[model samples]
Target chain A: MTSPKDNKSQIWKKDLPKHTFILLVLLLELFPLYMMLQISVKNNVTFNANQWLPITPDKWEWGNFVFGYNLIMPYVANTVFVAVTGTVFTLVFAVFAAYFFARYKMPLSGFLWAVFLLIMLIPGVANIVPLFVLLKNMNLLNTLWALIIVGIAGGQVFAIFILRNFIEDIPKDLFEAAEIDGASHLQQVINVVLPMCAPIIGTLFILEFLGKWNDFLLPLIVLRDQDLFTIGVGLIYLDGEYNKDYGKIMAAFFIASLPLIIIFMFTMKLFVKGLSAGALKG
Target chain B: MAQPISYRKALNEWPLYLLVIPSLVAVLTFSYFPVLSAVYHSFFDWRGGDAKEFIGFDNFTRAFSDEQLRYSFFVIFILVIANVFKMIPSIAVAVLVHRLVSENAQYYYRLLLVLPMIVPGLVTLFIWKFFLDPNFGALNAFLDITGLKTLLIWLDQTFLHWGVFRADAPIAWLSQPKLIIPSLIIWGFPWIGATGVLIFLAGLQSIGTDVYEAAELDGVGPLSKFFYIELPLILTQVRLNLILMVIGTLQGFGLQLLLLGDSGGPEGAGMVPGLWMYNRAFGAGEFGYACAIGLMLFVFILALTWVNNKFIRVQK
Candidate 1:
């Protein structure tokens, strides 16, 4: 009974609140980021005066970025070394375990997989004290090796859980075809499993890399030397040093967060898929 | 014909077992060993050095009796309550974003919502620390610019009569005991947690569209559709997120540690059990007491997780 114009108006009425809500949320989510960007460029004198402004071109001081970058570049490099090595080790161990669990029927496979799940249930903070002592005993304290080993070990359980599901989902025919052609277990994994599990590998790599890069407490506890700090630890040190210098601190914040932001922008789809995949399936 | 592999057959499958060895070794060394050590260390009076004595449940007894540790449990309870309420807005936002008219807009909005996840969590907390600084914080500046500062003072004096604020005084967010918890709650205002949204969205998307159309044909309104369809369907994800959040809040003291430092905030108001464990082991060299605290927390989390699983299964 309603006219086409009336129907159009009703649709608008229904959507108007939804659009408004979304826009408000976008503003709230972006507000601190906008403030960080604005303060990073604003000169110290004008920072308080124009704190609420999105940008101030006339009074901008680009020197903040230069100063912050110089201070944090070494830390960024250290983080990259740690995150990359950690991800590679985690992926290597996790892929092998996942392939074995998915394709091969080894003894006590069910029990082993259950134990991994049980490990996930144990709250991580409970292990911090004991792990600290363990690292200290091995004389690995104050070294990146401590973080790297823990990162790889901690990341593998979740990585294997998700990767096993992904590998199991691969068509059985592909593996059979490879095996019939005389592919050994290792050869079949290399030829069939690795190629089919690329998406998941990419997903776990990004997730684990991001987690290692953002980790604060482990690095703060393990590493004592300023030169060996990760970006998260380095930023805390920067905050203490430049406590009153808002401009410089914000600049450091931007620099510390830049790599992950860049990565997320490029691989956002994979990141989302990874997040949902682990949670939904697990 | 499906028989279990014998020892000889298992030996023949050595390659597969070999592939799992590295992970097994790593888990045993890092994960399992630490837990066992936690249990073993809890019974001793060892500090950092080799001066060890078997205390035999003294650490556990002391932890149970410690007044400060009991206060921390209360603080943790408040934080967990706040966290539960925080999930509501995250779910609402996810549902709203799901109903967006344009597919491109929906994708971009979801991306924008999650963009903050890329920022290091410590940096975000630091930015909030600055934003809540009493003297020159952006929050106060915004209130001043909007004339809300005067309005708030008037309301405080006339209606609420709390007498806590003067017209000229800036609120000390982190320094005051009363305002510390509120400041923690407000730190991530609008609380659009990226993972929560994504999980809920995935749950919603998995529902068939035909159910929605059928509901519409039944003259179901938006509220009815949400309660009757969306709510029940996404309950599994909701339950999962709740369990995760509960576990996370109980185990997490990083934010509290970073914000309050080793002192556990002003008057130890922000002290949670996790931070207490860190302080006991690292700061005070009471490793035995720390281990006891850690074991207790682990058992509590395990019990809570089991109860949650049972409750959710019963609801189904």
Candidate 2:
């Protein structure tokens, strides 16, 4: 009912501060990163001078990125191998487990799900000491397999939780229709549930990727070999050895962070969508 | 009449069970197995290098009676206060971002907010330590320009010698056992803010627009709408954030180590449970005792989380 003239001015005025704060917040958020980047580009001599801004006539020192890559590349590859293999295993197991939980009236299903809820609440640090012993006993210490196995197990609960919710959203009649066609439960899961839950699965994949990629504490304790370090563990090494080399460390951080940033940028909407959906329900 | 089930019926259902086996094995081996072993180890005096020695309740008694343990608990008590201040800024910024008009603008702000989360704790720890260093750090540089000489000696007790440059300053930050808790709080708060924002943003996105529209029609301004409509709706998110922050703050180590060093700084100012457990097991070579301490923390955290869940019932 407002006049067009009044509405136009009101809308414009409301948006200006929001836009300003948005820009301001974004800049403030990036400040630390900017600092990190500044450190990485400068050489030791320049960095020691403690110049916050990079001055003219100094190398960007792109070698820091290369050095970081060479230092952590094997670890990166190892993480990729672990993550991909773990994700494959996690998704496979979660699908069937979530399917069983959702569709079947199995004995103690409720009890089993309650166990998952309990495990989810307990933070990862609580079990580190015992896990170290268990892995030693199993002769899995310093092995990439240990990391993979642990990541897969830890990753499944969240994936299963989300996938179960997503699967429940599929109309029951779809499964009933497949049943009427003489399809087995296995076939029904593969044919109907899997395809419909693709969005949620994809979302879980990114979450798992970011998580395993950046994980530090577990890799620090579990993997003794320098070669098996993930980006996070590798960065820890960089920090220790070149503690004063802010420039190189910053450069290394930028290089290490790029992949995650790119992946997040591309799949952001889906990430938020899946996360909020899960959050809302929980 | 009931017919005997075909063998195929059992086989068909086996895939479902089969699919969950790997996950179960992994969970049992990595998580459940370790947890139970930790409980078992708590009763022994097995150091990392030595044979396991039975200690019964000795380790538990030591952990409870240790003065340093009592001191860290006091630190955590102070930290809980700092957390209250942090929650206010986090919620306000998150709510502000939700009100922004342009999608592109929101994207930039969100990415900016996410920047801190992406900063690895180890790296950020070192960076902040350098900044907070008593000597020749940027923080002191800024303080000097503003005629704030008093802030310099407060950076550390030994630096108070330079208080003459300040007219009269007391080096207090790392040296004072009492102030170190607040110091730790300052270090921990910014790192956690990003995660808080991201979680809150997700919560905010889920709130119904119709509620906001109705509020606007009822002559409510943006600020009032936020307090009445948005805040209540996002209480679940806030509660979730509190649960996470409590667990993380209780367990985290790198920052404390970075600022206070492995000795837990002067007078054990920055000691928390994680560092305490690490020192006992790794430093003092008391693996069994360390495992006991770790187990105690696990039980404490589990109880806290359970209590929080019970107390914070979501409106929905």
Candidate 3:
């Protein structure tokens, strides 16, 4: 395309500004995280010294890690349970509904699609009142099942919409061929659509998992039991009790962020493929 | 081709209907039911007894007149202004990354931006809380090292208003009423960076390369290219971002609770609608009034979004 790029140095020079800018932006974006890491390593005594430098020798507190884990173990367990159960429930319903929307051109299909869009537009806070009443009347307060059910239901619109978009992109000819081979709709969905929808399904799983994991408001309202609190809820309550305990509070914060950061680091490759991973999912 | 099936015949697909039933029920029961019921709940006054009474127009009037509720709008307004500076920087950084790097490198940066999104909110709060600590914070130390002694008062209201932090020194970070919203704005930058950058980056990716190539051929420089080609292309995204921010402010609760430890951070400067609702229900045990406030917020957000949609024409 240009002077037969024979030298790496020349190519690198041509891209220097862009590269520098990217590095700078990445650092800016990561500054707080770097600070978090530095603080996590240092104890309250070292933090009180008010130095910008990382704990050289005196402030190091690896004990915070063990203590933090012990403190947050139950909350992490609760979070995992909700995220997994919610994802499972959402995936089951979303996949079926997405398949129906994508494959068949039923009457009122556009209207149904519009309904999903409308749901997406409305803020989640809008429904807090009646849902609270409904759950309370049904004797479901402070229960893990309440979270699981509400989370799965609350996230349907975007999940269905995204799954439908991805599914629609799958060539219709493939589904037609399956039908011609004497496959029923369910079989076609399972055999043909499921595999093709893998990337989207993966994206939705992570999205839903993140949503349910980071959810604070719903759980704050519904769950009164400390043990029933998910990570977000648990973290709020934990910090409230130990606000000034910087080492332990920061430790708890670090622990709460650990699972997600780990997942993201491992899955960084997937996010780059133009994936719509931020879409809210049930 | 086979004769077209009747619409009635198509409706007989029991399996299809059955498959959609679970999701339909979930959406209707959880989403639709509550939305309608919130509107219904707004009109009635109940004090948790058999003394339920229809008090049409009363709750709406109260929300409008209530000083605390009215005061929240000013807080929201200030917060929006502060976000502009931070958001502009984030988007500029994001756009610069988009321009300089190949798709692969840009993706890496994008992932970096999303790191905070995945981080639990509690973690972010703690990180910022520590960072903003005036006595031993990296910020104040750096300011002193730079001979900008005024920076020590970065957290003070008097210094913040008088802009004389270096002189008087060491303002209460959370105690001042005027400075509280600004403080929230500063803290919000990192939190917003995670999701805001992602959405904008996605919006940037959707701009067609051919348009840029065409602009280049037309002798358009970088600034012109961004203004003419890129900016207009992402107008819908801007509208989306604004609407999201507005609605989010209306729903702001958890952040304040974490930051201020439940008293709304010095003079109720940081009190927002969502936190107000929480206080009413849980703190004051006025479930009926809280429900009314929640309903009002819902309507207000919906109306705001609808107006924004009308103005922005959400689709290009």
For model 2, residues A39-116, the per-residue Cα lDDT tens digits are 777787777675678656455767777776776667668777877887787788788778877775455566777766
lDDT of 1 by residue, B1-316 (tens): 1124577877877878888889988998999999999999999998966778998999999999988899989989999999999999888888887766557778888888788888888888898888888887877777778988888788778997755456768877788776778788877888888888988998888666678678879999888878888888788889878888889999999888887786688998888999899999999999988999999999999899788667666243
Can you tell me the CAPRI class of model 2? acceptable
Best by DockQ: 1
Q: Which regions in candidate 2 have their CA more than 4 angstroms from the true location?
A: A1-23, A48-50, A56-59, A176-187, A274-282, B1-15, B48-50, B101-104, B115-122, B133-138, B146-180, B188-192, B205-225, B257-262
> Taking the candidates in order, what DockQ does each have?
0.61, 0.38, 0.49
Scored against the true structure, residue A138 in model 1 reaches a CA lDDT of 92
Q: How big is the positional error of residue A180 in model 3, measured in Å on the Cα after superposition?
A: 5.7
**DockQ of predicted model 2:** 0.38
TM-scores, in order shown? 0.94, 0.86, 0.87
- lDDT over C-alpha atoms for residue A270 of model 1: 93
Q: What share of the true interface contacts does candidate 2 keep?
A: 0.39
lDDT, candidate 1, at A159: 89
Per-residue alpha-carbon lDDT of model 2 for B1-316, expressed as tens digits? 1113345664555655655566666666676777887888899988654478888999999989988877776676667666767787778788888876556767777766655655555556656665555553555555667856554445444653433233344324565665566567666434336656767887788766677677778999988888887887788788766666678777777567656755688878788777788777657877898888888788888888778778866555
The local distance difference test score of each candidate is: 0.85, 0.70, 0.72
B210, model 1: CA deviation in Å?
5.2
Q: At residue B156, what lDDT does model 2 achieve?
A: 40
